[model samples]
Target: MSTATHTATRMATSTAGHALGDSLTMLRRNLKHALRYPSLTFAVVVTPVMMLLLFNYAYGSTLGAGIGGGHYIDYVTPGIVLMAATSGALVTAIGICTDMTEGIVNRFRTMAISRSAFLAGHVVGSVIQTMIGLVLVVGTALAMGFRPNAGPVEWLAAAGLLLFLTIALTWISAGIGLVAKTVESASNMPMPLQFLPFIGSAIVPTDSMPTALRWFAEYQPFTPMIETLRGLLLGTGIGTSAWIALAWCTALTLVGYFWSRSVFYRR
Candidate 1:
């Protein structure tokens, strides 16, 4: 190949390598934060389990038909886990905003580090942490008799979907982190995301909701995600909801990523 072509190839490879490296470093830093604040980790890990018990025992009777043709808990566990992932991303955003406020990003900008590495790292770290939380929640469900009818491949597919959802939301959360005027608002940005599930097919069927609310709930992103996840875990067929979920995630990731880049450059 020509020297110019070779140079371009090398530069691309180096850029990709730097991005991956930054992600790893950020993951380590976040993991250290988690280790230092074990209480916080414990709270994030345990809160969903608590939710399961409270919802299942207290309100399970009031809930309608299980989407999975099983107990309500079995149907609701995946949604609860998705909710947990969404809620847990709040801390990740808070951390990013704190770093931004403290001039950590400025310091890194002065260094030889990759421009997008730090942001990429935060996203990667958050996804990993959310997956861990997911495992704990799933294990808790199994212990509580929440069985998945999905085979190994379907289980992997379901896990993959959750991971993608988590990563996609992380980008949106990062945008919130990057643009919030104060740390408080940045930290609370994920609150609305958590509530999305409640109005959707997460807690109850969207058809069961009031007509006005049902219209919004059925069209919202969370409904598709919850329905897709519920179908996978329940070993049901991949339906239109899965396509809708993918589209929503893709749109969110692109919009959030570009918005964040613009904000980051402006700062």
Candidate 2:
């Protein structure tokens, strides 16, 4: 390479390293903040656990029969896990909105750190925390007699898919936070997303729903994701649902990230 080219490459590498470092530092900060204030995290973890228990116990008998005598807990755990992740995504918005409203982002703007690191930190940290919460949800489901047929490889793939899904939701929530002028608004904005999966095949089979709702449950983004996750855990046929779910996840991630960045720049 020419000397000029070598110099540019070195500079680019150095900048990328700095950005990663800064992002990690901020990720630690976000995690620490969660540790200090456990209520939000607790709620995020508990809400889905409660839902899982409620659905499995209160309605499991009915729903189990509805799905051809299958174990309701097994059939519903994936959806509940998605709910937990979405609940955690709400925390990302609240954290971001809180920072923005409290002038922390202003302080960040005054610093020399890479601007992207702030969002990256929030997104990454939220994913880590949310994954931890997902584990708790799954454990609870197991305690409730949920049994999955997934082997080690399937479990890993399910974890990977959940991580990707969490990332997508977190980014979109980040954008909502950036756009919201108040923390209340930020919390409210992603509420629909948290519950959207319920409208899918979360509680029961999509085919069992009314015609219009069934069409929506099948065509909406979360149904394929839930189905793909169910397939991974239960050793069922994934078919094209995995591809469709991945496409939705990819599209949401891209849209949320750029949308967050655009709003951040404006602010």
TM-score of each: 0.91, 0.97
- Which parts of model 1 have CA positions greater than 4 angstroms off? 64-70
Between which residue pairs do clashes occur in model 2? Answer: none
Clashes of each: 0, 0
True lDDT of residue 35, candidate 1: 73
Give Cα-based local distance difference scores for all models.
0.81, 0.92
What is candidate 1's lDDT per residue for 182-203, written digit by digit as tens?
7898877778886678888777
Least well predicted 10-residue stretch by lDDT in candidate 2: 63-72
Question: Judged by lDDT, which candidate is best?
Answer: 2
The TM-score between candidate 2 and the true structure equals 0.97
Residue range 1-267, candidate 2, lDDT tens digits? 999999999999999999999999999999999899988888888999999889988999998997889788889999998889889878899999999999988888889999889999999999988999999889888988989989999999899999999999999999999888999999899999999999998888888899999999999999899999999999878899999999999999999989999999888
lDDT of 1 at 40: 45
